[model samples]
Target: MANNFGRVVEVMVSNMLFSMDKYAIEGTIPFDNDLLPNESEIKLWNLSKDTISRIKRNETLMINAGYRGDVGVILHGFVSSVLTKREGVDAVTSIHVLDSQDLSKRKVKDITYAEGTLASYILKQMVGQLGLPIAQFELNQDYRYEEGYTASGEVTDIIGKVAKDCGTSAYINKGKVYIRNLRRGADDVFALSKGTGLIGSSEPFEEEKFKGYRIKSQLQYRITTASVVDLKCKDFEGRVHVRSGTHTFSRTGDFMTDVEAILP
Candidate 1:
């Protein structure tokens, strides 16, 4: 009683869709970006001379992976590097890409904040200064800087501090920024049933000394870091907030999303 049940993966460079012939795209997008930036590796086989020349550094990269009725952009970034290798008779190419937020790795000369400011206000000002799009903002706690807080390091580092002060997670994905409240409850987007795309039983795990769950499911792009999921496995039945996840696509267009989440 469904429309479709197969996998479809598409990659676009600089807003132009590219052929998937002998190509594969894969990457992980973290929910909590306090550590690394969103990145991906694209492998192209037997590229034509013209196509090879089209592949350039600094071009924008966009990837959408889905199964059946669910489809959305799962990865987006700038092409960081391109490498060509000859394998016997065919030339293979690998493209490395980095999230848009990677541009914020530079030190922000100076940033001043007023006393008794709302965490959301501080985050808004920070992202505005960096020119990053706002995907979502939920942080509302107030932050008081007795002597005023001044940012003098990497922009990402300063944003990370603001996130910690509000007890939230902040990061950029697909060229959009997200500032989520860790203490707030989220509505379950979808109920993952055991017989419906659920790859395996949800198991309890430990991550960073915090309780978490490891989830494996067929490829779908609607869920991302900060999205709340309701698992209906026989072993576990509750909501878990996604902390990080990996979306992988094969040469045949098959896709999978593996997520690590913590209880809300």
Candidate 2:
């Protein structure tokens, strides 16, 4: 097991890099498959006047954070808002970002697909309209519209509809669109245990028909929505499908990834 001791963070805004090792930074980034864009709140402390002036709305923001050796990209999005204030003689800049902001809010032109058109093809077209790349587009079943289909309104909504028709779910992760089966997870599986950074015991919970556990571990970038994980704790031991999660880092000694997973 790699040492999860030293916290490392790097922030980039519009291609300008700011190392957290030099500047204190803290934030919470949440990821899920709720058919809505994921958002992040990043707080940077005591930056120079020129640095603060350069940050503007709609600029690209990418944050890479983890332990020294395990550091990876955790949040990639566009800045939606920037707020600065003075707290106890320190200047704090809070940057709020939205993943795939352009793609989520873009309204697709009304276009009717021909009869017998595959849902996957239409989904690709919608994503192409927003100019966002596809991370994964595997569907459990592809639906074919017999009477032709009309696509209108926001592209995110249309994608969600297409995913539902095809028996799956769609969501944006780190600026890429992913339409995947809920029952099956991604190919990469992370093993979590006491030696592998699993914190405490897994808490079991039942939500409607789903039975799963809420797990917390040292900040893991691999554990995202639709990712698979093999968890071994005193309370539970098995592989579960990650449904949703959050990767959080704070300078005041909090760095962890919390995820909700269900048995597959």
Top candidate by TM-score: 2
Q: For residues 117-157, write the lDDT of model 1, one tens digit per residue.
A: 56666667777767878877776565666666777776767
Off by over 4 Å in 2: 1-4
lDDT of 2 by residue, 1-264 (tens): 744568888999965898867888888999998558777999999988888889999999998887777778888899999889999999999999998675646886779999999998999998887787888889899999999999999878898999999989888889887888866745688899989889988999898878999999988877788888899999778989888988888766678999999898
RMSD for all candidates, in order, please.
3.0, 1.7
lDDT of 1: 0.69
Pairs clashing in candidate 1?
A: none
Indicate the worst ten consecutive residues by lDDT in candidate 1. Answer: 21-30
Cα error of candidate 2 at position 197, Å: 1.0
TM-score of 2: 0.94
